[model samples]
Target chain A: MVCIRFLKALQSVLDSRITVLYETHKGLGARFVDFAGWRMPVLYSGVVEEHMAVREACGIFDVSHMGEIEVSGPGAEAAVQYIASNDIERIVDGQCQYTLVCNDTGGVIDDTIVYRRSADNFLFCTNAINTDSVFCWLLEKLHGREGVEVIDRSGEYAQIAIQGPASLDIFKIAFGIDTEEIRPFRFIETTVAGSLAIVSKTGYTGEQGLEIYLAPASAPAAWDALMAAGAGHGIKPIGLGARDTLRLEMGYPLYGYEITEEFGPIEAGLKRFVALEKGGFIGQKAMVERAEGAPKSVLVGLRMEGSGVPRTGYELFSGDKAAGNVTSGTHSPALKYGVAMAYVAPEFKEPGTRLNMQIRKRSVECTVVAIPFYRREKK
Target chain B: MEFPEDLKYSKEHEWVRLEGDTAVIGITDYAQDSLGDVVYVELPAEGDAVTRGETFGVVESVKAVSDLYSPVSGSVVEMNDAVVDGPEAINEDPYTEAWMLKIELDNIEELEELLSADEYQQFIEEEK
Candidate 1:
């Protein structure tokens, strides 16, 4: 309900432009689906084909859809630390940390990335739907904190992700920078194709890639620059369909689908983001207590023992009892098997523990498996 | 999108290629395209009875799974093992090799209630 209210408020304030791919999507026979209220490309050639392309070579994505916020002035780090689950103090400048913003009750507001640009400046990268919520939350948190400024810069920046093994080479030529020096979770404010861009060595695809954040008007130019530089490397433009599969293959959680407000960060297998030792965050005490106790359910990976593929919202069973339900599942092109992530009863979370997933009304056999069903070879 | 002129079509995008009392059932190219990607297909076992307009199987995509309904009352004579093993065949070539099952019909008259290629195309256009 907060998201709905926030979206209504945002509509009154922001004017978002749909990208050119919206038209190109229809041309490529893409089944356009509404994602976070934007008409997005779900599939182009196909999800499976696009998913395989990212695993094999390079798959470009118009992630311009993700929300961007800039926090400047002194006390920006404290403002983020007081609101986010991860310890902001631990993160060094030019580095990014995956963190969760939580409600007072320990429920997830959203999972976000905090990019520490400097002691006084920071950028919070978040999901498209939760931009308003994150902005409001930070604005309220920093109300009396002098010298701190929270600005919703979502309308200004466009995000593009070139994901796969060939991404580093693609970044090197497009930006004329030695991208090999950039480590994971690190970023550099550099010019690419004559446009100011923040190139970050981070992605959800479990591949070596850079997510370029630049001006919205310059996005098409940046995309063209990448495609031109990467044409020889077998890079192809990918849609959201491939992005989901690639992330699912790596066991990366997607907001609204895998993680939701009804669940806390610890239960969602994101305990790493919960800074229990840190003092006085919105959900700190509740999360700390939960960490010491047992979770009602723990997220685990499941594979169908037979042939059928498990899907989101499909019930997971232990004997005749409804133990859990699937959150994300896919037919991994690399594994050549059906893989899924589900929050089952704690007893069922052990690796190799046998379980059942209701495909239709039938109880199909399954087993808990290790996550990242397909891990690409390290670069 | 291929909608065979000789076949009977359902609003749900199923197609029935009839030859006397026998019928070959599969999803149409329109169905495959709408489904986005065919990751898995669950078909009824041979000898299983299917009622007209009842769900006979399911086709799963990365985003969603849709129930496949039978257009005619029939007994499953043979399930397409190839489509089961390689569900992507329906995405690659939906019209021919991706047929779901071969059925022995109980009521051939049910085919009369379904749409032809032109009618199905019109039905799809109206749906959009």
Candidate 2:
């Protein structure tokens, strides 16, 4: 009876999930919040300050909450190509492709990055909340199929992303590896902080950066090493609050917000990722049919002309007619103005087209603008 | 979080400073600290009627939005334009510089219902 009561007390105390770097975050003065059933840091110094740090200098993020799934065997290539919307064959070893996992109805299951490891090995980095569903979907789809195995490796690795213009220098100082030759969407497998890790030249922020995946046990040491090395370059510990703002400034689609099971990739303006000509893939037929028909709503970027921030689910209007609604919206720290991504009628999709966004009870004027609201200039 | 002795606090985390018939209102330091880096603020215009315990405006942080409730019901005499232009000031000094509105008090007795500095501190402790 004592043991059972103690176990129940322990279970109650450990209700919420936490990542491997939760202690590290708490030590850095992170503000904790309940995110997708996980106790994650929402901010440290501040959202705007950390956001500017990533844009101007360097910032590190704990992305261990992101899910990782491995598919390996002789049939891995065939299975991946059938499920993913992107052409997995296009990426060689050491290359990653931004792709979408779709259901049979052509709705997005999760937007993911597929890394080609070898001829029969591939890894998928999925959204944190959709990890289990994605893993189950992959298993159910590939059930009874020979020679392919799906394994969830989410708990095996801790992911860290270092972003900004100064990330390359910090990475070199910390890892002693030259990443100048590694192009975007490419990764290299090597030892980082005495542990095998995969360093990829990819990030959600529209800045030059690298995402490192390594063993969870080695993450704290690796994070400390990077922080020490990056101290000279002004690297701030970024939190998920700044992460959302950074990605929002780039008009990147968040899983639950911009891409959902109700909307298809074509309507979400991700038709390029869907390989329509390459038939036999799941959702290809429905996606192709969607591509042919006139879309009911199209996702477009909105720049606020009036005061007030546009929030998700806010109704949008073209003159007096109800057009659509906002999916993801934020006050852009980089632009110093409110910006949003909304799904609107096709007629109101053109840049400079005027629209009214209902923020609370007030109707705020906004204009349709081209996406990628803030793009870093290349040297 | 610093709660001023002269200012009365509401259960909704708003502070009110009674100046004769005028009541200056703003979010408390505890409220601003909890909100974290306020990005935008929406305030009712001057001459707008406000009711006690009702949402008079909104304060938006990077990740969340919080409603600012009225401590005492009255007519808005003035709304702070400086705070509206730069919402981050709330995080810097929520009490003085970020005062949201000055209202002509409808009932001075309403201030009696608010918590004192010591009471507000105890309330926040219990809240935590």
Model 1: residue A317 alpha-carbon error in angstroms? 2.1
Please, what is the TM-score per model? 0.93, 0.95
The C-alpha stretches of model 1 lying farther than 4 A from their native spots are A1-17, A20-29
lDDT value for model 1: 0.83
Error of 1 at B78 (Å): 3.0
Per-residue accuracy of model 1 over B19-103 as CA lDDT, tens digit each: 6678998988888888877788888999999988899988987767899888888799999999999999998888789988888
Query: What are the candidates' C-alpha RMSDs?
Result: 2.6, 3.8
Top-scoring candidate (lDDT):
2
lDDT of 2 by residue, A119-193 (tens): 899999999877877888898899888999999999899999999999999999998999989999999999998
Candidate 1 per-residue C-alpha lDDT over A229-334 given as tens digits, one digit per residue, 9 for 90 to 100: 8889988778887788788888998888767877788888888888888878898888887788888888888877887777788998888888898998877767
